[model samples]
Target: IGIFMWVSSTEASWQDFRKPCIAVVDAKTPTTRIIRAVSVVLLPFLVGFLGYNSMKPSTDEPIELRTVHPAPPASTKVHGKTFVLQTASNPYRVDDSGKYSDKVQNDYKDGNPWDEKAPQFLQYVREGGQIFFQNCHFCHGDNLNGRGMFAFAFNPIPANFTDAGTIAQLQETFVFWRVSKGGIGLPREGFPWASVMPPWEQHLTIDEIWKVILFEYWHTGYYPRTWD
Candidate 1:
């Protein structure tokens, strides 16, 4: 009990000493007092200026989110009656038939009907870039080199689109199909590595998917094969 009282009295004495010491320091002037006083007056303005500049958008940021058109809102309505979203098991499972047995001969669904001659080719590619950054950049990297932020997590890393084996040799149709179907569409050969690619069909329209493909080719400087 006495020890407790002594500690309490000692703490009180220290507090009292600190109050007077603080006052003494405040009373005296240091050599840098003027500079400190000026700084204190200007600190808020300095902070405001820096904050404003920092908030301004960067020109070099890969994608501008504000200007990009967001994906269409999901709707369950089919007719003028009660609305319901069509739910089914993985669609790929039902069509296990040789989907790619005759790749060259097969009439693979081309997402983007518009070709390079189209006036909106550039615009489509630009929009596709925004989409790629939003959806694919995490796993495909900013350069689409497959060394993305999450690339290390996958057993077999994401395909490097820049490689000759990837977008260079493959037809746009194959690329489109693979992207739309994603990991679920992986055949027996693509199995066991644990692909993380998600089906983009639900989120991206066929045209949007094709646009991104166009961006990949243009950015990588690889030309698609001609039917000739």
Candidate 2:
């Protein structure tokens, strides 16, 4: 009697477990048979449709990417003098009217700190390099390439001293005026000056400014303009 009871309970549990699976496809019931048949036919078609859609290429147009070129520098005249753009479109005119213009021009023409192999000239270049790294490197970069740490903060970006469009075409007097007066010295009649370059007259000695200029030309292998 005990064995018979245990076998009866086991059969009942098996029937309970199989009840759901049997109901899923009860062939005698028309509704269950229809659902099972529809699922068997439609599942493969649905999967195939999805797979086909996934494999198909997109019909959208390709995107075009054009290079963004910087605008050319504008030309302007200041106080009966013509000033052209140099180094990131900054307008600079030679200091032909200043007291020390001739002196600065003369020193530039001498060209010792760059072309000379003499010990004193080399020493001058060395001193200029020291000054540049100390004061100017933060904005102009160690390579004088103008891509300094703070360069991205400015719109037009810092002057690329290595570019031929910059120091290559400029006169030494131009350099002198820009360095001594900084942004405030820019003529009001010219393009709106918005640079943060401070007046170095209060900060750097005149001699130190000159030395840095020499170092710039020497380091970059660029020569100052011989003409106006």
| Whole-model lDDT per candidate | 0.58, 0.64
Candidate 2: minimum summed lDDT over ten consecutive residues — where?
87-96
lDDT of 2 at 45: 88
Q: Write the per-residue lDDT of candidate 1 for residues 31-113, one digit (tens) a residue.
A: 34655555666777789889999998887735322211112112221122222112211111111242322221122223342
What's the true lDDT of residue 126 in model 1?
65
How many times do residue backbones clash in model 2?
0
Q: Which stretches of candidate 2 lie over 4 Å from their true place?
A: 1-118
* Cα distance off (Å), candidate 2, residue 61: 30
Q: Tell me the spans in candidate 1 whose CA falls farther than 4 Å from its real position.
A: 1-119, 188-190
Q: At residue 157, give the lDDT of candidate 1.
A: 78
Give the per-residue Cα lDDT of candidate 1 at 130.
82
Positional deviation of residue 139's Cα in model 2 after best superposition, in angstroms:
0.5
Given candidate 2, what's the lDDT at residue 208?
80
Which of the numbered candidates is closest to the native, going by highest TM-score?
2
